[model samples]
Target: MSNKHTTLRKPVLLTSLPLGVMSFLLPIYSKKLGMNAVEITGLFSILSLILIITRPIIGKFTDSFGRKPILIVSCILFAASYFIFSIATTSVLIYAARIFQGIATATMTISTYSIISDTTKENNFSKAFGRIHSYKSTGSLYGCIIASIILSFMTFTQGWKMLFLIFSILSIYSVIEVIKNIPESKKIVTVKCDINKNKSRNTMKLLIIVFMTCISSSILGPVFMIYMQDKFTNNILLLAYAFFPALISESLLSKRIGAFSDKCGYRYSMIFGILICAIISIITPSANSILILAILWILSTLGGVLYNVSEKNIYTDMIGESCVGVMYSIYSIVCDFGLMIGPLVGGILYDNVSHQAPFYLSGFFMVIVAILILILIKKDSICRVD
Candidate 1:
């Protein structure tokens, strides 16, 4: 990787640390604040709904105005979100935080991916994206560790505030890094383009796959923490320990799998990955022991690692370089569409149906995703650039 790529990832790494903490705490916190299952999931749906609206505009700005400014704004918004999370006493405040967080995600995620696409060679996309994801994993792991420690020492309320406050400060540090070190990734360009028919078709197929993948994954989001709390001990440290293996394995292997995807076909890798995850999801609801659940989680994460690394590279391969930012935003919009629906459905299923319903449904959708991949994404489309 070049110095520029390295620099770009630093802010991403830093921000991801806080994101990890938020992921671990947000649902639990929402529950504590008297939110029901549907309400808890609604927060995420609201966030994704906002992303669907905002990401395209911000993504276009990145392509036109350059990546650096949008990235810096993203960092600041992250800090703002963290601060709001820190002070939140009601669901309304949490809702506001999700809004800021969603917008921040729209900007930072699009800008960072665009930067990687701008800086790296086409063939090296998986390797480069792998490293970026690995960095995010590393940061998230450490963030969880830190959160565990904080929760270990303090009351839940105190620890929650402290975690958000500390990460809010760290987000500022990321902002400074962006201002000082990161360079603009691409020259400013207008988004006008005459897209090819094949490229457009491939991009649409890829986005459909992404949408299904999001649904399959997000179906578990609203229920995961609640399930853990009910089934396992509520000790934050123990929860973190259970998650450690998956995070560690994902961090270590993301880059390697990316490199592997670069050599082997992304289609094969993605198909295999999705099937493995689908199998795991099918079995997860049956695990009676915490250890079995943890094991299942680890396997599921590995499958996700494979699927995500390969899928990202394939999208980059399919889209034109000039409108990559817009294309990525569009991709995210489709993915968020799934995210918005999945959690609501998951929450309702958990509340009205059975706890296992979401997992079963997720697995079913994942199988559909795999089928879609097999039929829609042809070998010729993946192997050769049109």
Candidate 2:
């Protein structure tokens, strides 16, 4: 990587790390605060809904103004939101904190992604995106390990508050890193209203494909750990262990998949990913053996990495420089929608039906997404050419 790439990487890594920390700490903390499953789900659902509504406006602002101002403001909001979360005594307060957090999260993520996509070329997207994912995974690993240690030595509530403080400090550091190290992309020209000016049929197709891909990928994200805990005796250690493979595999193998996607085209790469994920989902329910479950978990991670790398690169390629932020925001919205729905649906199915039903449903959805992507590729080939 060049010096410029290195510069961009630092801030991206720093920003990702704190968010990763929050991801692990928040749920555990929520439980400690006496939140029921329904409350927890409702909190996230409201957050997702807020993000879905706000992303496009944030994306538009990033395009019209610049990435730096939006990013800095968002980071500050992110930091302050944690303070509110730390002090929350009621469910309504929790909901309010999450709403602010959601807005900040959406703004920071969309702006940063827009900056990275603008800085990197189409051909280099996979490698860059892979590195980003790796940084994110490393952050998650560190946060989870540190939080676990803290919880072991202290009360859960105390550990949770400490984690929130840590995240707030990290957010401040991320802001500094962005200011000192990451340079603004020289290629991004200020656009007034071009975000909505031109829309190609291919762009619409790409957006639909990206939406489907996100929905399929997020099917198990929120509910999987819960399922594991319920079935395996609610062992936190075991739950953490089950997650290790997915995180580790994605951090290690995503770059290779990204590089492959750059060379082989996003369509083929995503197809392979979706197929593998579908297979894993279909087999996951029948795994009476822990060993098989672990293997499937790793495979699912591999598939997710492939899908992420390819789909992101494709979105950048399709939208190009003009509307990258808006495109990414749209992607985020669809993804969060899926994430919100997945847990609710999974919980209902697990309660009313078999625990295995969620996996089958998830697998079936992936299959549908895979077929949609294939159809998109055919349509694009018939109408557009280089």
Give the number of the best model, judged by TM-score.
Answer: 1
- The per-model lDDT (C-alpha) reads 0.83, 0.72
Per-residue lDDT of 281-382 in model 1, one digit per residue for the tens?
A: 888877787788778878999889888888998898787577777878887888888887788788899999998889899999999999999999985224
Q: Candidate 2 — which pairs collide?
A: none
| CA deviation > 4 Å runs, candidate 1 | 28-39, 188-191, 194-199, 228-237, 351-353, 380-386
TM-score of 1: 0.90
Task: Write the residue-wise lDDT of candidate 2 on 16-78 in tens digits.
Answer: 554544655566667777989788767767878889899989987877678887888787777
What are the C-alpha RMSDs, in order, of all predicted structures?
3.2, 3.5
Q: At residue 205, what lDDT does model 1 achieve? A: 80
lDDT of 2 at 356: 80
| lDDT for 141 (candidate 1) | 82
lDDT of 2: 0.72
